[model samples]
Target: MILWFTYILVAIAALGGLLCVVLGLAGRRPSDLTVGILGLLELGLIAQVVISIIAPFAGNPPTGSLLEFWVYLVTAVLIPPAAVVWALLERSRWSTVIMGIAALAVAVMVWRMQVIWTVQGS
Candidate 1:
């Protein structure tokens, strides 16, 4: 895995978390800008997933279990939309808080994925 791409995604996800948390602390519901940030993060995660899936086929497989890598990748990709849907359903500042947590979770998952990619027997 390219370290720069991982760094970029991690930075964006961390920023997203901070943004949503701030919005929530301000007692505001999830706004379009917040959703847009999540949307962009989701797109990046999806692209990462695509690259991860293809890398193995291109003879650059992970040293770890490919299935585990994919599971983590998929989970990371799905988190933003699920958070958005739940945020819409709740219609409260807590929903924004949920997005913050989701973003943080995705960031952690991505980090674990990087470990899984580079560390043998992970």
Candidate 2:
């Protein structure tokens, strides 16, 4: 994984999570801003997926367990859509909070994938 891109993704996810949580705590329901941020995050994840696929063949294969990295990537990619669906269906402050939590979770998972790629070598 590219270090800078990973950092950017982490920052975006963290900030997005914080924003949604604060909004929810202030008694606001999910808004387009929140959903849009998550949509951006999902797009980034998809890009990462493509990069991961290409990186291996371009002489930058992960040093850690490929299985573990792929599992994390797949799961991280799923979280945003799930959270957005819940928020849309519930239309409540708690749903916003849940979306925030999901974003935070994705951030951590992405970081872990980075570790697996760059630090944990066989």
Candidate 3:
């Protein structure tokens, strides 16, 4: 696991969480900008997955159990899309709340991935 990448993901998720909180507080509905940001975040996650997939084959075996890594990877990849679809269907502040929760989940998963990597390394 790349510590830098994990940090970056955490930062992104934190920012998204802040935005969602602000939107919720201001009584604003989910907007296109929010969706766009979520899309970008999703792309970033996809990139992370791609890099992770290639790293092990490129002589950098992941310092984590393959099964756990796959679970985290798949969930991270699914989150943004799931949030977006749910937001579109809901179209309320609840959508933003859901996005916020999703972002928080991403952060937690990143942390877990890091821990898994560390444990495997030991």
Candidate 4:
């Protein structure tokens, strides 16, 4: 688990969250641009999950409880798509706001995962 990659991913998630929030507050619906940004964040999250799965075998497993780490990872993996679905269901600025919330959650979760895997490394 490269710390720099994880840190960058976290930053992207945070910035993505801020973008969505700003769009929502500005009275804009979930546009193609927002969806694209969310997709990119999802890609990063999925990449992290893949990394987490392979890290154990690579001899750098998380020192914290694997169950908890897996739980957080799985939840993070679902956030973007779920938010997109929610935004699709309702075509209002608030829908984008919901996605904004999801993005924030992704940021926090990514940061937490990094702590579990790197800071607490066994």
lDDT of 1 by residue, 1-122 (tens): 65789999999999999999899989989999888889989999988977886787888778887788889988898899999999988989999989998998999999889888988674
Task: Provide C-alpha RMSD values for all models, in order.
Answer: 1.3, 0.5, 1.6, 1.4
Worst 10 residues of 4 by lDDT: 113-122
- Give candidate 3's TM-score: 0.89
Clashing pairs in 1: none
lDDT of 4 at 64: 78
Query: Could you tell me the TM-score of candidate 2?
Result: 0.98
Candidate 2 per-residue C-alpha lDDT over 1-122 given as tens digits, one digit per residue, 9 for 90 to 100 = 88898998899899999999999999989999999989999999999999999998998989999999999999999999999999999999999999999999999999999999999968
Q: For model 2, where is the 10-residue window of minimal lDDT?
A: 1-10
Clashing pairs for model 4 are none
Stronger candidate by TM-score (1 vs 3): 1
Q: Tell me which of candidates 1 and 2 scores higher on lDDT.
A: 2
Q: 1-122, model 4: which lDDT tens digit per residue?
A: 66887888888888888999999999999999888888999998888878887888999878877877888989998989999999998989999888888988998998888787777744
As for model 1, its CA RMSD to the true structure in angstroms is: 1.3
Provide the global lDDT of candidate 4 against the true structure. Answer: 0.86
Per lDDT, what order, best first? 2, 1, 4, 3
Q: Which regions of candidate 4 fall more than 4 Å away from where they truly are?
A: none
Off by over 4 Å in 1: none
Q: What is the TM-score of each predicted model, taking all chains together?
A: 0.93, 0.98, 0.89, 0.93
lDDT (CA) for every model shown?
0.88, 0.95, 0.81, 0.86
- Model 1 scores a TM of 0.93
- In model 2, residue pairs whose N, Cα or C atoms come closer than 3 Å (at least 3 residues apart or on different chains), thus clashing, are none
For model 2, what is the C-alpha lDDT against the true structure?
0.95
